[model samples]
Target: MRPAPAVVAMGVAGCGKSAVGEALAAVLGAAFVEGDRLHPPENVARMARGEPLTDALREGWLDAIGQRIAVSVASGQGVVAACSALKRSYRERLRGFCKDIVFLYLEIDPATAKQRVGSRPGHFMPASLVDSQFATLEAPAADERALTLDATRPVGDIVASAVSLLGEANS
Candidate 1:
């Protein structure tokens, strides 16, 4: 049997990780997992207040997401997860969980991200924290397992690009 594919959609807030991840999962015939749902209420509240989450605050959340990936891997299920794995260390934690893991970095400019965040209603992530996200983000270039997609493109295009990248990698 072919090994299961585990794709992680990663980026800062408002980079369309959730949207792209869901679409990519559908395209790839994989199960979709939204990482934000795994965040503890305290972490959510902190981000909602425009405060950056400290490593201590993010540790449990990262572990939870990593464990979920491990579960999917063990089940032989293809999984696509939406998460802001902003740091290399965080990505490494996920790498420890699944051997077939690939990261899809949704690259976007700050202005576009801020506009999207501001226009979106009823979202906990405030536009004011966009700068902080940029500051915290460590782009995942140089990682051969990573694919950088321009998130400013249309959703259809983004999904197509991700699908193509995944297919190429898995082939």
Candidate 2:
């Protein structure tokens, strides 16, 4: 029998990773992990002050999240996760822990990302850092276990579409 699906909803801040990840988890009947909350308090404080985190700063956090995903899947507790996963190396690191991992990249232009982040009430990521987020992002390539969707879609629509693809893959 096939193991359950483990998904990561990935993008820059304000691209709806949390909302969509939660919705997809609901649809898939999987556990939801909020990657933003998994960030260390110092990382949160630094970003809240409008600082962009360096790769070195994000390594441990990424590893921790990857471990959670692996444990969940190993236990047959499938999950949907939200993580920025901005760079290719970061995605690859997560993949190293779970080769069957699937990434759903929510692609957004810088202007929209900045606009959304600016309006967000209490998020640690400031609009000022959206540019750096874009600079770091590497959209999933064709060969990867991933899908890219427009980030501007309605939450329901995005979740429904993702369910179709994931359900198909699982079948």
Output the TM-score of candidate 1: 0.96
Per-residue CA lDDT of candidate 1, range 87-106, in tens? 98889888888867899999
Residue 16 in candidate 1 has what lDDT?
Answer: 96
Residue 54 of model 1, lDDT score: 86
Model 2 regions more than 4 Å off: none
Clashing pairs in 2: none
Give a tens-digit lDDT track for model 2, residues 1-171: 788788999999889999999999988889998998889999999998989999999999999889889988999988898999988899999988788989999998889889999999977788999998988888888888888889999989999989888877667
| lDDT of every model, 2 decimals | 0.90, 0.90
User: Clash totals for all models, in order?
Assistant: 0, 0
- Model 2 vs. true fold: TM: 0.96
Q: Which residue runs of candidate 1 sit more than 4 Å off their true CA positions? A: none
Predicted structure 2: lDDT: 0.90
